[model samples]
Target: MNLAARVITELFQPTVTVALLLLFSPAVEPGFPGTAWFGAVAVLFVCVLPLAAVVLLVRLGKVTDHHVSDRRQRAPVLAMAAVSLLAGLCLLLAIDAPRSVIAMMLATVGGVAVLAVISLFWKISGHAGSIAFATAVAVLTLGAPWSPVLLLIPAVCWSRVVLRAHTVAQVVAGAVVGGGVTTLLWWLLLELTVRRA
Candidate 1:
């Protein structure tokens, strides 16, 4: 397959995107407690849910001998995107700063949208995206606590590459999608909320 196709596929992978969002939430908002619960929800919605859906689809495909194609695989990706949006909303609710929630949610969604658009047009390397995300986190962290959770994004990206599920570019695109979206959301949420007040 071409690099563009591969990058899009990797970007759409539900697991990587969702995991990145969850990992970065705490890093962005230190005052928002209950990282464990956020992590748990992310795991369930982002990882387990898509996995279960994949299993069911695989079983159905086998029973019907339906040759699974890229379109079929897109179901999980779509689910991941939906989950990421929901997770951002949940994170907004979890936060104590009412003024920031909406802006944060907007930034989160906007970032993901931008990443999706970019993935559609360009092929990104895995290391590049991972490094970008890590750097973004590091930059965002200048004022917040040094969160161990930040490491999870790279770990998830590595797993996808090691499993041969995605190339370096694809994984990196996923990282970009994950981090860019969340960061945008956090900033927007803060700004809008503050403005209204």
Candidate 2:
């Protein structure tokens, strides 16, 4: 890979997307309501813990890279991630957290569920999928103020292609799955919450 692609891949990894979106939750309308610890619990369970476990796995040779670059190794990792994500979702839901946080968690569950299923047959671009989803959330939640972040999707896609981590088709598929699922989940959550009240 060339220097630019390497830089892009390193800079825009899936971990960055998770961290950025969670942190950015605060600037939008009604942010993540409740106590300040709400954000802490969210950041810890939803992002940090699973990420740390993955990093430890890499260090212990349970996986190859942060991306889980090997197709064969993806399923177990993704399955575990989905469980962690689901657990976090349950926690947030139990607390009666902000609607947006609950909605985002539901979207994440949707994305991971899709990834887990796809991993059985092919290696898809988790990096592209996640960043696209995060970008979509930013745009939907914060409107025009968050438009610039949408650019990250293509940049990350290019990096994945350039690094040979994914083909154009795979990355595109990932983007579609991530963006489509999250958008649907976000809209559905909002609409359903309105109905329940």
Q: What tens-digit string does per-residue lDDT give for candidate 2 at 1-197?
A: 57898898888777677666655543433533434355556667667877888899999999998888998989888888888888877888798766555666676778778887998898888888888888887787778898999898888899989888899998898888866786677668766763354
Scored by lDDT, model 2 comes in at 0.76
Total clashes for model 1: 14
> How much lDDT does each candidate structure score?
0.50, 0.76
Kindly list the per-residue Cα lDDT of model 1 for residues 1-197, writing each as its tens digit. Answer: 34544564356454454455455555444445544455445455545665565567678773221111233344344446557567656764675423333443455456545554554445333333433444454556464565654665666556556655557777666577656655655655555665445
Steric collisions counted per model: 14, 0
Off by over 4 Å in 1: 1-59, 62-72, 75-99, 118-149, 194-196
Q: Give TM per candidate.
A: 0.46, 0.87
Prediction 1 global C-alpha lDDT: 0.50
Pairs with backbone N, CA or C atoms under 3 Å apart (clashes), candidate 2: none
